[model samples]
Target: MSSLYDLAGPADAGAPGPSDPSDPSDPSGARDVVAFARVAAAAGLGARWPGQVALLGPGAAGAAAGSLLGGAVEPASLDLSAVLDRSAAGGLVDVEFDDAAAVRAGLACGGRASILVQPIGALPPEVLSALAHRRPTAVLTRLDDPALPTRAPAPPGDPAYGDPDSPDSLARSLLERGEPADAVAETASGRMLVSVYVPAPHLVVVGSGALATALGAQLALLGWSSAEVTGLDDALAAVDALGPGDGVLMVDHSADVDGPVLARALRGGVGYVAALGSRRTQAARRERLRAIGVDEASIERLRGPAGLDIGSRTPAEIAVAIVAEMLSVRASTSGAALRDTTGHLNAGRP
Candidate 1:
């Protein structure tokens, strides 16, 4: 039998294997996604769609609910049982959906969707692991355009090819931008699809107060994860739990709690650190941090009274405001109203 990647030479042909995600040097975790997409494209699988194979899974409404195969033998027509069969042999297939047929199936509420079919093992283990852990990642896919070369001469944003100053590395740029989600862009090479995976921010609330509880519940509603640290001694471990994009909410307000916790957070490189307090309180905290040897720059990073100026009164309202501020910081936005911002709304986006 011919291999799925036969058209692309071999899976590990002359091309370089994907970089190790465990390597601390490659923190983006996009290398595997790029490698797999490249393989699929070279193999001419889903040539039009590049890296994906769609399956007509649930939420598909229409008249032809049972005719999922659409009387076709293409990979997309494979049913659940067939998919299981293919997986047993390490096969990947694409399932296409016909909206009209679905509408005819007498299903009024379900919508049409194509599922990307593949064995769990076919995917890069690193990408899967990162997703399981809610780490921030981006998947950059280059389309097969007859007009363009088979491979891009250089990674986007690289200094190669006479433009050392160009910061066009698509993967890096995407990582620098907003929440991980699907985005499209036209590049010098061709059109590209970027599937960004921004794991929900894990909020570390360093307090057992009502505000901390409310914040945890609110984060849950947003599908974000939160770790609550009630005691001062536990603050360090909680602060250490934060990854690159995670945040620290110091609502505990006790110098005993905030002092060591804030110092550790600043030193450890948490994305956001905010304490609940007034201006005078923040000043005092700053002084305390300095005495503990926390530098001025790190002290400056703290957002005391952490929240937007929406005039929050209750604990719930405060939670909303603080979360909003953290989100704004994460997105690198000023938290201003969208109506007030000018220029292409998605200028920096893919």
Candidate 2:
């Protein structure tokens, strides 16, 4: 009854060194793939490996372009200009037949090294979902055969469209739709590569309203997880549809529609809660909550006027401003443009 995660020891199991046994540095047990890049760059291996996948192991980080290349070629001769071929982000591993190329990757590009491709074997659905939420996953490719089904976390949501004989495999689960899972290892030996979509950061917008719709559209372009809802029912549905590292963004422009929704969403441990309204509108709503015994401390987290004050006049402009603010929050920026910025207090003298 154990998941593939439990069996394969997570994606970075084959990575270097002993992990911190006292306390896990990351909330997700899987390594932080982005951090792996910096580590590889620092290890003097980034420039030495031919084509290798550096596995950073659990509670650590993902691999770097250098580590992946190390797996493909000799680790003692990593160089900068070795014709590096990289893949898109998320924990992706590439298995190549060529043992004489420099395989490097940047943050967000996940192509595992060339060893474990074909025999990745079967994984549980929920485990795949859990794996998709910031978990590092290793994928194997058979450089010999290509009719193998490569397994990855199911695409974040249901099929965008369901049609039989549509030839579109979006509806087919990642491990089931294509080449049979049984052939994964064999096909790779024939020159096919399999990549796993390690769970990346995503945001889930629970609530179907103008705000929800707008947020969904905007966040999609930003590569964040988002969904919409008209009522609490829809909100629940959206939450049910999302994976981890994902949260419910309830944009309640209408108090009548948002009051209970906001309360419930907050109680559900939503990471970001911002209601679309003015200070007074939010205050009035807060008082309404007080009347119902919701404490001031619990209600204070609400970000009213939800976005940064950018003098936005139109709904579309306002939507852009809100998304920008959210991105700023995510990136830990001051929401100030570089063109208008003064000295950065955090910048140290060279």
Candidate 3:
């Protein structure tokens, strides 16, 4: 990253953003992450899409990521127990992870030793969203601690290995390979704590208008991506244009038009479907949707008010709440910024 220009030549150059000067919500620092990653990938490193996972544990996180590389390429562990030095492809780097170090290095936690896994390519959509918005995410990693009785924890209904509390071996391996698994689990006995600083959730906001614009700016800070989709037809078309793991947020809901768009979106297997409207308007729309067989479950995920219940007044505030809700539901957790605490965590990786 010292000479990022040597990487991809600016990706079209808009000034390497360090988003704002002091705002923790700025996306600039996040850009540093992307630049370094892209450079590494361009250099032919073993990093790739969805970004990378920075494991927090002993040699665990490193071993986990290296294992994820697949094929027969085993990760070389440079335990701090040895002197740090430069070598060929199989060289070693001396480093140590701790609570204070986590904050300083932006790894995960202070007390835990971690592996900072960074994808060598474009980060996963979720990580990108988190970066753009400056939100915290939960990550799970394993422990060599003797406190746990040595049994793999039950799969917490989440494919992310297990809960972000304790990650299973499979989760660590996948994360190392650059696939973004939602949760990670260790087991019933392992030390459990979620790594935070996950990128914000992204929402492709289709349709242009006051709402779209307002939402875009607001979501940008809430750790959500708010892209504008102009019309119902355009929105529907965009849905088809999306790849797997993409999410959409639609505004300007005209029953006759948006309803069909919603149907197409649902059928397309989009993750989150939301529209903006007044209470009465949303209720009536729901009734009509059921009449057309849109189903109660999908309808339930639909946020009529489209935001957390913070009683936001301005369009900007409302937009914040909406994007916040999108992130909450996307992670399947209640709304609470992850930066202030150290309970659950996930690293945004390739």
Residue 313 of model 2 has an lDDT of 71
TM-score result, candidate 2:
0.44
Quality of model 2 by C-alpha lDDT: 0.41
For all predictions, the C-alpha RMSD in Å is 11.0, 17.7, 13.8
Please write out the lDDT profile of model 2 over residues 217-266, one tens digit for every residue: 77768645454556555555444333323444556556565666666545
Rank order by lDDT, top first? 1, 3, 2
Candidate closer to the true structure by lDDT (higher is better), 1 or 2: 1
lDDT per residue (tens digit) for residues 207-241 in model 3: 56676778767765643454566666666655654
Candidate 3: C-alpha lDDT: 0.44
- State the number of backbone clashes in model 3: 43
Model 1 earns a TM-score of 0.59
Please give each candidate's TM-score.
0.59, 0.44, 0.45
Looking at model 2, which ten-residue stretch has the lowest summed lDDT?
34-43
Best candidate (score: TM-score): 1
Judged by whole-model lDDT over C-alpha atoms, candidate 1 comes out at 0.54
lDDT of each: 0.54, 0.41, 0.44
